[model samples]
Target: MSGITTSFFLIFAGAAVVASLALYTRQPLIIAYIVLGAVIGPYGVEWVTDLKLLADIADVGILFLLFLLGLDMQPRALIDTIQKSTVVALLSSLAFASLGIGIAFLFGFTLVECLVIGAAMMFSSTIIGIKLLPTTVLHHKHTGELMIGLLLLQDLIAIFVLLLLMAFGLGEFSIMDFSLTLLSLPLFVAAAFAAVRWIVLPLLRRFDRFHEYIFLVALGWCLGLAEAGHALGLSAEIGAFLAGISLATSPISQYIAVNLKPLRDFFLILFFFSLGARFDLGLIGEVLVPAMVLATTMLGLKPVIFRYLLHGLSERNSLAWDLGFRLGQVSEFSLLIAYMAAGSAIIGREASHLIQATTIITFVVSSYIIILNYPTPIAISDKLRRD
Candidate 1:
């Protein structure tokens, strides 16, 4: 077998064994994936050293994940969700950003580092929040709508932040440049909706009887729109999401969603693995103290802040608390932002390491808390485990 093929075999085989052990021990399976990556990664046993290939493949997982989320949401329903959750999302993000800025300053980070870290902290993990949510709740309950809405809003914020950072990286940061980039968002949205309404939807309706063809077209459309978005200076993720949203009202959307899940999971494992494999264990020690402090603070404050915001928005206390805990973690976007900022030399290595370590730490701890206390697909108790 080729080296990459051998690495894939090692990764999947290792993942399967570790996943079983995680289930047996009543731990979140995601933790197993990360641990698997670390053990066999270049820094560990050197079983897999092709980090670039894995990272590139892993990005598809994020695209599919966003696409599926868009598939689940109807345009009207999404609008309603945004209306209800907008205030909460914005306020909570500001609060989180403030917290991050304060911590970075306390640690004596540079102004640029503090600002970038602060922006990174403003998001919660869409993957963790949605993956752990039971389908019953997701499909039939208000909780899912609320969670999805807030997450969508945060994603928009994350995208804008990434664009700004990109501009900063290219040394082209300016008010006019930022304004023009922001303008491209609505323009893309308009163009995507028009294309879907006139072209994609008609084709789907015409070919509705052919399952295989329908699946192929859906995949093509998702990636095509994603590429177009990137060409227009937008993120592929935002483009793919809009692609899903455009088709959300179609009768065939649910069918597409159900079938795409297995494919999405395949990429997601690679995403988490790449995330783990990229971590340099040796560098972690240098930022250990600040990372721990930042992680602990976010974990403690997120739930409290979310609960307050949701309750003020007239959500029931119980429901607000549940939503709060579900979203109480640093996001995968945080890591992405940290990676981008560090690569651009906008943030120091220690600052970047702090974001990464804190994000992983929160992922593990938050998964444990949510699984134990809420109904999830992998909850330890049968009563709490709902698909």
Candidate 2:
């Protein structure tokens, strides 16, 4: 009875109870998912220790999330925003990475540890950023366009950084391989759009009334290209995003987005829960002081840096500040980098755990600040809940 089936029961059942309590206490349900995971996870109650399965599914959630975002994108707008936001993304990432390196060095971490730690800090949480964005603002506003552009650029940079980390991990870096990976983006984009025109649109047009068929095709198209992207040395998220964009001009794109929402949410819960479940609270003491220092500094500093940077580019003070607060957290990519670094022996477990703890702290604190002060999909205040 306590096999995988029971684990599912525990996860969903516990989530329901905790989420209800969070609502009653005027807290975000995201916190409830994390708390439930920690309480029921291996390090706490010693349940659901085999996390590999759930983690795999969690990746799918992210793939679908990016795909959905691409589906909503107006390609021309995305291009213009990308051009405007590229400098912001690069400069802001450089600032955050420098801060991470300085903090890690001051804490007496080794040179390698400091570099890896700083590399991890160069992005923000895609899930958190996109999830919190109110749909009213997201699909229509200039701020939304700019935010998406900046995030996408950071994602590309994260992928490049990850490739270098992989090269370091293997003790063999290849210039040609790196060059090819960079070149693959446009080739893949062209291939995706071609497929949509030659294959997907025709099928959907022919079987427009068969809702189930459209669903299956959309899912297949997303995952199929995700795998394709991975084969081409690009990230699966990028591939899935391209797949979504290929269909963006279709009349059925909105229908596909609406239908996929529930499925996306179901998997996203597992993604957040898996985060809490994987964190070892017992080992946190080793990294606690540094984690607290890093987290607090990042929370206070990220918004200020972003606000000034965006404002310097001619964004209004209010808009720049809002974007800044919204992005003022360490990224999910930080956790991924920590994992990869530890796995590759580029950083020790202690350093990896430091990254995890710092990220979790930022996730929790940054979210509270955003929901309290801004309009979001899950704001505690009725007036602020714009979704």
Candidate 3:
């Protein structure tokens, strides 16, 4: 118990000092958290060596993030965003996948490795996309709607990819397994709404005046649905999203969203820290050249592709470019795909290492670019700091 407490204390205290230094150096606090993680993680000082525990800690933050996204999405806006972005997301994802496939092929990866790497490239980091987004932008702008729609759609696709990969890895790709995967999502959605309408709303009404109770109930609802999603073979993030969207029509939705920010940020710091902590610097030698090429292409091309597609669809130039820059990074899903593929022996250690190294590179470099040049909640410059 004391050991756990001490480790957390170190994490937090280290975060504070690093964050202060980041501010002094005009760097994003995100860089600070990640750097602190690498320094204290098993790869460095070995203070926190439990990757499983780190992932669990990270996932909670991401769940809250998706939940908060749902909270802000009014039904009409969400529907419109989905309608507008479906084509854009599909096309953009295809382009990204092709880039990965081409790169992997050129580097002499096997067919399976090429395919898996391509699959991983089809997503942008949801946490990076939304966390850096200014609240004012998200609440008031069309850009927000499109980015949200794209990120969510990409996430759904990423989940499906994992499911397919899982079945492939187990060599049990039956019709029944496929059917269950397809059927589970809508059923879970329906169940979530029904529970919210029938059970959650009533409880909230009964305890309308009790702020503390409302808070507790909100957490319970989110975590409960998340667990249920996992049990149903979906995902906790998806479930948390459903939990938030189900309550979107409620009067207290914004109140809940507002109150959850602090706790969400608390977990998010750990999430970013864990990202750094888990990075294997030893892979740098084996994967450096490919990782650099991959990261550079993603950072340079993603924005261009997104911009052209959006512009072709008649979006404003500024908005198109902004959205492009905001979303032009590899996803957390990419790392997961590589991990799963490697564990399943679908890819070799070299391929997995390349994917991991590329992802970390893009994360750090892309973050620096965004913070230095664009408007974000944690931008280094006063002019760029939308917060």
Candidate 4:
């Protein structure tokens, strides 16, 4: 009857369909959700007219997803990964951004538009990459570790860039703003670290025996840290990540991850599907050429540059190449950054649409590639090592 009610049913039905497809096809569930959204959304048959409601709800899913990701991360592991991943992530981002900007410039896009496009190209799809990597590969191989490492680095970089943009747009770029942001960064980290170390860890130890308590406590830890981070002018995603790192060393980390996974799946499904529903099909006709050009550059050139960068640092070729592929797609961060840019009037609605469309395209295509290659890579790695 109402928009919300109609949206609820559609989301429910769409999620089921996507879930079934994901289970049957062994494809990433996110792609299924996006496909369902595109088919059923306003641009399609108009089966769901209240995509705005769903997008708001999907924000909760994103918050929860980030929270869970935080729970899964370990501080020592993150630091180690960053130290190892810096060279690859840094060089790859620079190279990809340069290529993306050059491509956009060739298309007669403005400097700011090129900057946004460049930023978009610098990141890979965290959701798709994580979802597609095999569990065994994730834990057992140097390639998987490197992929994970670079992704973590990208997340941090994305959050900071968002922060910088916000600070600049808010006209808060004084020495005080810099000092505050800089000081806030480490303080947030230390606060999360301390909370998990002294408070959450003890609570977890006490509650580990009770699955329900463990679950609730994990949720609280995530939201609480996110709220705290928001209060301190940092991104909630960064806070959630720190929260994950804080509890990363806990004995119950694995248990927490396992128990919370279903919740993660439920929320993330809403997220990806909502993304599909928000598509502005009209802009595609106007910006499709640039979007495709940017997408192609990111999907093609990003991995190549990343592999060379890592190899230059003396990393193994297979690991470098694999990590490169894993990190090639434009990230959802690009969408978030474009939103910020739009608010600043630096990028218009058309530019934002271009970014979102290209992001979704890259996300779907890249996930498909990863899923198809995942098993083959494992088998080939074993054979080559033995040979």
Listed per model in order, the count of residue pairs whose N, CA or C atoms clash below 3 Å is 0, 0, 0, 2
Better of 2 and 3 by lDDT: 2
Q: How well does candidate 3 match the true structure in TM-score terms?
A: 0.97
Q: What's the residue-level lDDT of 352 in candidate 4?
A: 80
Q: What lDDT tens digits, residue by residue, belong to model 3 across residues 39-102?
A: 9898898988876786788789988988888888886788788888988899999999999999
Lowest summed lDDT across 10 adjacent residues in model 4 is found at 378-387
- Candidate order by decreasing lDDT: 2, 1, 3, 4
lDDT of 1 by residue, 119-203 (tens): 9889999889999999878765899988989998998899889989898899887888778777898888888889888998889
User: Candidate 3, which segments miss by more than 4 Å at Cα?
Assistant: none
lDDT of 2: 0.91
- lDDT per residue as tens, model 2, 278-303: 99999999999999999988889989
Q: In model 3, what lDDT does residue 68 have? A: 84
The sequence of per-residue lDDT tens digits that candidate 4 reaches over residues 189-233 is: 777777777888888787677888888888888878777777777
Ten-residue region with minimum lDDT total, candidate 3:
1-10
Native-to-model Cα distance after best TM-score fit, residue 16 in candidate 2, in Å: 0.5
Cα RMSD (angstroms) for every candidate in the order listed = 1.2, 0.9, 1.3, 3.6
Local distance difference test scores for all models? 0.90, 0.91, 0.88, 0.74
